[model samples]
Target: MKLKSFAIFGTFLCTSRVTLAKSAVLDQTSLIYEFPNNTWVENIAARNNGELLLSIVGTPQLFTIDPSAPSPRQPVLIHEFTDSLDVFGIAEYQTDRFAVLTGNFSFETGDLGLGSWAVWSVDLNGVKISIVNEEPTLSSTPKVAKIADIPPAQILDGLSLLSQKQQTLLIGDLSAGVIYRLDIESGDVATVLNETFTAAVPIPHFAPSGVGGLHVRNGELFFSNVGQQKLFKVPIDEDGTPSGPVTVVASGLSTLDGYDDFTFDCAGNIFVTTGGGNSIEMICRW
Candidate 1:
């Protein structure tokens, strides 16, 4: 019995060492572009051409900028939703076709404007418009269209393409602590996932807002719970329906403040943005 106990202790030590060694660290950093105060950049998506599409929440606007550009890179305005006050999330659904979330939200009050949440799309392959401050130079003008209004969604903070062929979008609701799947073609919305893992802890300053980062990859739906300070995944079908139980991928992340939006690289490494912590962390699978 003593020898068995020692073997267990040895295995525990080995496991702990491996876990600690596998952690990722920021070895180098570089600034690409910085927006002005109150810009409230919420979400960003990569264009097929290697440019980045930014969704600004402080203002109802979408902008695109070339990351490869030199210092002082300027983000050209793509579209400004005068009807809405803010834009939340952006995701590329097709080639140069992106889906966007917009609504009237008050930063000061931290309250969403009811009945104002809607989904919109922008096609960068549309008409050409003159460059900003550079006359005679034309850039592709985005064709903007309102897809549907989500009257039931209190705060859809994250948007992702569930399936390109099905024309379905997976929206994360921070306030509701649920995931809603929206059919882009039929304008139909349905609740797909909701459980304790997505629930937010109540705080004094603001109401409980739950899930943040959301993405679909390898037949799995991955998300981050800001209020819970954890990352979770659920096996999902092509239609965004849950096929397996929710599982915690990472937890005990109180030090990171909260996990907001994230993206998976080609190597399956998850790059998560720490919302209040003001840092980005890369989580390795191994």
Candidate 2:
């Protein structure tokens, strides 16, 4: 089978096939879709039904694109955020349900303006839409709950569903340089990793913290560091504790810059989004 690469620029979705030899060659190129120019796609989550959910940083909106649809495809705006909140990371909670992390911040400067943060349960069924998960009680209009009462020093950039059955989540703190595990059922949060990186490339006067993207696959947790420009994997125990030292998966690849979030295809191919460059890249072994 041939390895295919899908990259998204400002509005154009470019598809290419890579022929790996001593050097990799782009065999073909095609345009898949063209999104709105103002849409700054921060992260993407693939659904089981082959649809894609995109988080936009430029606006407080979430879009869904069905590539399997007929030609001349268009992305549908499925969700919108109010109260100046913008989605940074998203993960599938169930079939049509999703866990969305939102905060009040500037995507350009990476500055926390109001310093508000919360996790929400978004249902894509019927008329019922989004609900704040941190509410103390379940009601028709439950009050929004903050993740924690601590100071707004860390930027929660990435989120992944730890276990659907256990209702747990894994979140990465970009500024604080740590990974936190949150229990959706009990509202308990804990730190999983807290190692500081000495060789971090400062984000050019912006937030200069390590740890960018996060994903869990095959009982292991994988993360990327924008400062270190590296990707590492660690064994995660059944109880959600990281058990072993970090193993480097890939590093020093020129295609990656400010690696933000990544997802795996059905064939196990990895697709990474670079925040600094605003591009998507596909990785596969020859």
Candidate 3:
């Protein structure tokens, strides 16, 4: 019984702040897993063999967790999209494949209209289960191929994986705050960075902010900005252009309000996910 707590039904606003390079001491713990409270867990990937992929917002599911399973974490349901699609920002397109980013949005009007978006290539064995009624039974799925088409003023949230040998991809346009560079073998989309930032946060209604979590280390290109709660880093020139200006790797940290999506761990540690503060925050370096 070392699994902690895992429930999933909304109401979990968390906020944290701690930055250090050589002096560490931030151990906020809460490790739970077992989704489905009307499920809404968009984006989270980690699988070199450890397994853990989750992106469930509205439906067209995709959930999996197998932390070497046995202790109490079972969260299976692996892949299932095409009810008009609704998966979002998933990466890892090589072994067992996975590079999704769909959006037709309308789980009854969570509204993401103007031009349904796409960019798929999933096949982790394709639609496994969890499509409980309302149609979608699968017959020969998973080999989806749509590639690119995001222009309704952009709302294709995050998706990184810049080169499966030049297939290229790095889209992140949370409502036109721009950061595109998709070339998925020739769909050609480019707009490197438009500098995401869109304020107004009193929360009640009025959403569609800008750029939220997108990574690409070593060549630098980290971003975040739920209405500028801040966290940026630029410099990437080898042809995928984006050289100079845009630095502020983490700023004014204090609860990190609504910045969604971010993951990195292998000891590098930096886990950020803040949907109006439903938290998943961790930043360790030391």
- Sort by lDDT, top down from the best: 1, 2, 3
1-286 per-residue lDDT for model 1 (tens digits): 0011100000111112222222443333356676654456787787777677778776888877766665556677788999988888898888888889988877677777889999998988743334456532226656889889999888789999998988999999888888989999889999888889877666434567698879998899999988777889999887788898998887634554577788765656676766655555666665
Candidate achieving higher TM-score, 1 or 2: 1
TM-score top scorer: 1
Off by over 4 Å in 3: 1-35, 38-40, 44-134, 144-158, 161-165, 169-212, 215-222, 225-229, 233-235, 238-242, 249-258, 262-273, 276-286
Worst 10-residue stretch by lDDT in candidate 2? 135-144
Model 3 lDDT tens row, 41-76: 777776666566777655667766655444445576
In model 2, pairs of residues that clash are none
lDDT of 3 at 180: 78
> What's the residue-level lDDT of 59 in candidate 3?
69
The model with the greater lDDT, 2 or 3, is 2
What C-alpha lDDT does candidate 1 achieve relative to the native structure? Answer: 0.74
Tally clashing residue pairs in candidate 3.
0
Alpha-carbon RMSD, candidate 3: 17.1
**What are the per-residue Cα lDDT tens digits for candidate 2 across 1-286?**
0012233422222433332232333344445466544555667776676667777664677767665555555666666778545777887766667777777767566567445666766765432222246322212331233343223425677788889888888888776778878887676778878775312356664667577789888899888887776677888885567788788776644633566577665556666655555445566532
Best by lDDT: 1
